[model samples]
Target: MSDASTNAGAGNGAAQTPVQPKMNILAQFIRDMSFENVLAQKGAKGETKPDIQVQVNLDARKRQTEGQYEVVMKLHITNKSKDSGDTLFLLELDYAGIFQVENIPDEQLHPFLLIECPRMLFPFARRIVADVTRDGGFPPLNLETIDFIALYRAELQRRQQAQAAAPATGQA
Candidate 1:
């Protein structure tokens, strides 16, 4: 084969990248969300003053086959009233997005799938969390923005440090 033909053949696959599936928002629903105010009535009456505290956590997982992925974002929330010592609320939401990934190099794909994709879906997830909390009868929760890339890097560092600290096992 001529050099030009050889080059053309080699470039065909690269040029005709696999057409990834379009991200489908098949389902966007709150998996689990709960609210409990132990002293709500008492606090409302001002009989018992309560200090409010809020805590949040984020988690995600990816499942891929061939050239498709299901990315899930789990948001866990807790709200408490201090003075009245009452449990205000607890919410857990699992929001997911179906993504199509194809023809991307491995190095770039990791970050894109792990960080960028989730970041894109976070706002919708946040809205769900806020709506659930508000509909449950409390003030709407405006969650702070999250840096998924930073989180991924921190998690990567943690894993690396853990591996380094672990005693080497004989079995490789």
Candidate 2:
């Protein structure tokens, strides 16, 4: 093949390729946070096992600026004694980030926001949780890595089940 034809074919192939996803973090902050040391108030009498529970929720909204969106991660943590069923501590935190994104298809934006965006913010949120718990007069709480994809799928399944059940009960 001639050099001209070869260049033209390469150009066409490159043009058909999809653009890469782009994202920039404009800012990240803790929007709201609260920690309560229930054990301190109640007083620990003896050794007890800690039952810890963690819940994570994500939300995203568009900003006024073009291509700018805000993503928030809401984390709730609770600690209780397994032996006595006494509450040990409660932590609630809302961490948010301003993200400027490009090249993501409209159909994929929601999942990307809920999954990838929060995945980016998880380390910082985890650090905050550890700090707060330690400051509350307990051992530092090291959080486990979360699987955002699994969480999103479970949420979708939960919603589907609720919707499916709603119609069945409504007719009765």
- The candidate maximizing lDDT is 2
Residue-wise lDDT of candidate 2 within 40-71, one digit each (tens)?
88876667799999999889999999889999
Compose the digit string of candidate 1's lDDT tens values, residues 89-167.
6667776776766666767776676786688788997787778777877778878887888878887898898887675
Worst 10 residues of 2 by lDDT: 39-48
Least accurate stretch of 10 residues (summed lDDT) in model 1?
48-57
Cand. 2 Cα-lDDT: 0.94
Clashing pairs in 2: none
Q: Mind sharing the TM-score for model 2?
A: 0.90
